[model samples]
Target chain A: MLTPLFEAVRPIPAIALVPVAILLFPADEQGIVFITFAAAFFPIMVSTRHAVRALPTLWEDAVRTLGGGRRHVLWHVVLPGILPGVFGGLSVGMGVSWICVISAEMISGELGVGYRTWMSYTIVDYPAVIVGMLTIGLLGWLTSAAVELAGRRVTRWLPRAEEAS
Target chain B: MTLGITLESLSLGYARGPVLNGIDLTIRPGEVLVIVGASGSGKSTLLRALAGLLPAHGGRALAGDEEITGASRERAMVFQDDGLLPWRTVRRNVELPLRLRGLPRGERKAVAREWLARVGLEGHEDRLPRELSGGMRQRVQLARALAGAPRAVLMDEPFGALDAQTRAGMQALLLDVLRDTRATVVFVTHDVDEALLLADRVVVLGHGGIRTIVDVPGPRDPAADRTALRAQILEEL
Candidate 1:
């Protein structure tokens, strides 16, 4: 039921919706936050749906035969089975959120790395703009790395075949 | 305690059509009854019905006096592909049924460990399913199934994917384990030799029904000459 709506909204770039976000929200911060959330939500939702669908029926059968009900199957089989895929989405979502948040900040009024960088560029402060750009890059890399680290911790059971070699 | 499964005019199949029709059989308590047949002969279907994984198209299946309507912990199933959860450690996988049964964490851990030891998977308990060899994974599956102490075990070609040497070792391990428990076993295999070796009675299924039920004579000896019996089962297939 929600697929058609999601599909329609998914193709519209979050960055492209800044004007609409400004119209909808009372504050620039709220608009920026909304765009960031929108940018992250789609990838995570899509990956989670695909992950749930791709899970093998055998695992559910195994759980059921062991006297597990629907709740047990959800806890033991479905949730863990989709962790890897969900994490994949989360990592991608983090990166996309960074892109949108930075872009939104640059386009709107406020204080952030993107706003600072834009301000420095307008003022022709080359060194300050470079510093602001570096700060944004560092922040993006750190957030992505944090998400990936958390993903690795929860999905430790996954075989790192390439790493083994 | 072991369970005696009764199939009274049980018919099983998917939505398309019936696969096994009007099947009637009584599996005695504590007996290893192996069902053998060619591919698509409904051996696995019959096993699935016994496990309550598949519903009967007609009539009823009974475990003792209770009608088999759905899956229960009383009838555990082992599959050709080891169904151990990929994310769980070997010990945790074996402890799954116990967890489902609402056993306390301490008791679940103890029972899971004991069963892991029984299946010779002691040192590998902490490892995930993907880390284990095929044979090792199957061992973990066996431990997981038997750890629940189900009254009956319904196996659908559980060892069919293993190589000859590993299969033989698994067979020996299974025989050893069977001697210790009274769980009624309904094993489905395409190999006639496997049926003869493991079964107290072999049911040959063909043409959507039981073709013949052969009683394997004597003390379940592997060394005994049975060329004639082998030929008889092969001919039925």
Candidate 2:
């Protein structure tokens, strides 16, 4: 049910929804939150669903035949099976959310790097704007890196596909 | 604790229609029964039914006197896909059934180590499934199916992915493991030679039913006799 809704919204950039969020939410905080949520939610949900669907039926059968109960299957099989995909989505979502959040903040906010960058531009403080841009870039890279690190830790058993060569 | 299996006029199907029917079969304790058929002949359906992985549309599946309404830990399965949890190391995959049975961590680790070594995977136990070759992964799967010391093991094309030489080696390894464990085995494969090599009795399936049951003369038949049996089975097909 939610899959269809996400599929519909997946193609549209969350930044594009900023205008609708501003109109719907009374507070700037709420609008920014909504934009960020929109940016993050779809990728995570879609990838998770895809992971579950892509799982081979043979895996479940193997678990069941081994006398694993429903709870056991979920704990041992399904949860571990989807972790890599979930982490992948999370990393993507973090990047996307930072993009949308900064855009929303820049358009209308009193604080944050985005707001400061826009404010400096208005005052012709070009170096300050460059500093703000650098700051946002640094923050986005750090957050994404953190997500990647978590992904690596959780999915340690996964073969390093990128390092196969 | 070896177990015999009995199927009584079992029928199974998907939403569309019946896939296999009238499967009244018995596998003696410690017996290896290989089901062989053409692709899409519902051999897998029959194997799954016997393993209690499929719902019976009609009739019954039993592990001895116990009615098998669903999969049980007593009847472990080695799937064609290997079914190794990609997130788990080889040892963890082998120890999976032990974990499901609620064995304590130390004992589980010990059992997993023992089985991995038995399967010639002692040093490779820490590797993930994807890091191993197809044959190595299959050996892990075999260890996993038997590691928990289940009474019966169900196999679906267990060695179908291997090269001829590797498949031969695996067949030998499988025989050795089963000899030691005495677990009732029901193996499904399309390869006639594989069925003859591994089975006490080969069940030839056609049109969703058992066409014939061919008894192999010995554990490892001579090459000439093996060829003869293969030709005969091919004729039956």
Query: Top model by DockQ, which number?
Result: 1
Q: List pairs with backbone clashes in candidate 2.
A: A67-B73
The docking category that best describes candidate 1 is medium
lDDT (Cα, tens digit) per residue for candidate 2, span B1-237: 899998899888889999888788888999999999998888888878878878899998889899988888888888887688888889999888998888999999999999988889989988888889899999999999998789999899988889998898898899888889999999999998788888889988888788888888774642536777787778877
Give the DockQ (2 decimals) of all models.
Answer: 0.79, 0.68
Report the poorest 10 consecutive residues by lDDT, candidate 2 chain B: B219-228
The top-ranked prediction according to TM-score is 1
Model 1 scores a C-alpha lDDT of: 0.92
For candidate 1 chain B, the 10 contiguous residues with the lowest summed lDDT are B218-227
TM-score of chain B of 1: 0.98
lDDT score for residue B51 of model 2: 82
DockQ for model 1?
A: 0.79
